[model samples]
Target: MIIRIIDGITEFTGKLCAWTLFAVGFFITFEVLMRYVFNAPTIWVDEISRVLQVWVVYLGAAYVLKHREMVTIDVLLSNPNSVWRRLAETLAIIVLFIFAGTACYFGFQLWLKATMAGHTTDTYLAPPKMITHAPVWVGSALLMLQGAAQLYRVWAEPLPSDDVMGGAH
Candidate 1:
């Protein structure tokens, strides 16, 4: 049940990230049209699009991890029959937990600091820094959650034959 919930959340976030591509295209097109046709380039468009891109990339990472789509060099763990495969997989998950966990912790701190400090961009939009930092914190938190789910599966559930190397056969 918990895994399903995490998977659902990951899927939903992935979809949201996918939609940002359209937003990015729209923003770029609008900026170009306004700049060339009216000689009025908006100051906010570039920054807004950049932020959207960052959100898409970061949020999409958890989805990738959830689906086991991220790249992995598994040459040493290729032997499906080897007992060390599980150990290697567990080690990899530990590394993920450490990295994602640290990112989540620090990202939240950064977000909180920016929010409390009333930090804003110097640009005309002057959007709060939280607008930019929120995604990092949220995405890293999601990644950590997904990693926890993966770790649970690794230890508690029986492994599928195809997933012997921590990925699809």
Candidate 2:
């Protein structure tokens, strides 16, 4: 039940991240056109695009993990039926959980500090630093939540017999 909610969020977040990537590309293109063609470059596009790029990475991390797309020892889980595959997935989840949790903790602290200090970027736009720092904790939390769902999935399913991962039976 809870796992379903996490999966739902992960799917939604993935789509959102995809759109964000598009936006990042669009923003960069717009900046390029403005600078090269019109001889005028906006100050905000560089920073905005950079922030969007970072957000895509941080927010998409959980989606990556949920789909088993992150870096891994493909050979270990390649069989998809061996007990070692499940064990490897579990270990990977555990490691991601730890890393995400730690990132969330420190990210939240840093975000709070930036907020309390009323810090802003040094650029002309000078957006609040909290706006940039927010993705760290938010995305880490999502990754941790999705890790739990993946952990559940790894244990609940039975091993396949017919070589579902494209290898011989």
Candidate 3:
């Protein structure tokens, strides 16, 4: 029951992030059209778009990892037995956790420093650097959480087909 709840929550967060990405994309595209065609450029649209892009990429990364969709070279390790595949995937998840954890830690530190320094972008509609870095911190943390869930799933569930596996083609 606990595992199922975690999975559901993670899935919901992923979907929400995806929807946010779509909204941001649509808004940015509309802003661009309005600026070029209607000669009414938005000063803050570019900054907003850039921040949203970061959120989309990082959060989407976590979502993909949870869904076991990230690309990897597992041609040689593709095995029919459930145990071997699960072990290989667990190893892969360990490596991913290490990488994501490091990124999150450093990203959080960067966010902290940016917040302390009170730095803002140089624009007519300037925004804080923390605003940009916040996504990196949040997204990476969620990614780490999803990675933990994936690691659990690899051990709990039966090994899947290579084509449908995380480290597979």
Q: Which stretches in model 1 have alpha-carbon errors above 4 Å? A: 79-82, 156-169
**How displaced is residue 83 in candidate 2, in Å?**
2.4
Would you estimate the TM-scores of all the predictions?
0.86, 0.89, 0.84
Point out where model 3 deviates above 4 Å: 164-169
Residue-level lDDT of model 2, residues 88-150, one tens digit each, is 778988988889999999999999999999999999899999999999999999999998888
Which ranges in model 2 have alpha carbons more than 4 Å from their true place? 159-169
Q: Which candidate comes out best when scored by TM-score?
A: 2
lDDT (Cα) of model 2: 0.86
Q: How far is candidate 3 from the true structure (C-alpha RMSD, Å)?
A: 3.2
How close to the true structure is residue 61 of candidate 1, measured as C-alpha lDDT?
87
**What's the C-alpha lDDT at position 158 in model 3?**
62
lDDT of each: 0.83, 0.86, 0.78
Give me the candidate number with maximum lDDT: 2
Query: Residue by residue across 1-169, what tens digits does model 3's lDDT show?
Result: 7666667767877898788878888888889798999989877777787777887788777778866677866677776455767777888888878888888999999999989999887776778989888887787788778778777777776655656645545
Question: What is the Å distance of residue 142 in model 3 from its true position?
Answer: 1.2
